[model samples]
Target: MYIRDVTKVDIETVARISVEGWRHAYRGIIDDAVLDGRSVGEAARQWQEWLEDLVRRGDRLAVADDAGQVVGFASYGANRDQDNGFDAELYAIYVDPDRLGRGIGTALVRDMGRWLEAHGYEDVVVWCLKANPWCRFYGRSGARPVAQRIIEIGSRKLEEIGYGWHTMATLREE
Candidate 1:
């Protein structure tokens, strides 16, 4: 698989991956009703607007492509929490559920880390739903549990755990 910045051509594919990833990964963790109405076309339009905004803010979105198709993606930018003390945050990272364990997610993250480092960001944070098993992936990626919060999503109060990395430089080691 090859990793690079997200492009206009990858919008729909990435959005579809986002929807599918959430559906598959959050099946038992998140409220089913929240994921029920998601569709690729609608997600694509939403992601298009988000991507444009990210671009305007100098954020980075990277995609993992296998055989010219988007298999995974990661987006990162300045930390959202005012007191997090982190320079950057991994806003999102998801690989097609079918492609899990093939290193696509890892590669996308490494790319995002490198991009963050190049932009002079040393520390980064990633938050995942506490009920989601995918949080283990962050542990394996060298992030440590640092914080937690409850976020309301469509009437559901979900607990989120924050993982932090001291530096992006180490993401290049492995």
Candidate 2:
């Protein structure tokens, strides 16, 4: 697999990964009606627009491409939260369900740190649904559980936990 900055050509695959990945990740945790109600086409369009904005703003969106096919992605930028004391925030990371457990997610996270480090960001933060088993991935990568909050989605209140790395050095492979 190869990692690179996202381009227009990757929009569709990224969207598909986002929609399907979210469905897979949130399956049992979120209300079925709400999760199942998501529209792939809509999600694609929104992702396309979001990608454009990220590119325009000089933020980073990296994809894990396997032989020309995008199988995963990670987006990061300046922290959006107030007084979070983090230089950068990992807004999202998703791999195609079929591609999970192949080290693609780990590679993406490491690449994200390299990209952020190049941009002068030392500390990184990420938020994941508290119920997501994948949340443990961050911990395994050496991020510390730093905070938590409740977010509402389609009439359901879900808890999210924040994981933080005081420095990206920990993400480097031995």
In candidate 2, position 66 carries an lDDT of 89
Q: On residues 1-174, what C-alpha lDDT tens digit does candidate 2 reach at each position? A: 989988888888888888888889999888888877778888888988898888888898899988999999999988989587887999999999998888998999888888899899989999999999999899888899999999998778999999999988998864
Query: TM-scores across all candidates?
Result: 0.96, 0.96
Kindly give the stretch of ten consecutive residues in candidate 1 with the minimal lDDT sum. 165-174
lDDT of each: 0.89, 0.89
* Alpha-carbon deviation at 107 in model 2, angstroms: 0.6
Give candidate 1 regions above 4 Å deviation. none
Residue lDDT tens for model 1, 2-111: 89899999998999999999999888777788887888999999999999999999998899988888899999998888697788999999999899998887788788
92, model 2: CA deviation in Å? Answer: 0.4
Over the full model, what C-alpha lDDT does candidate 2 score relative to the true structure? Answer: 0.89
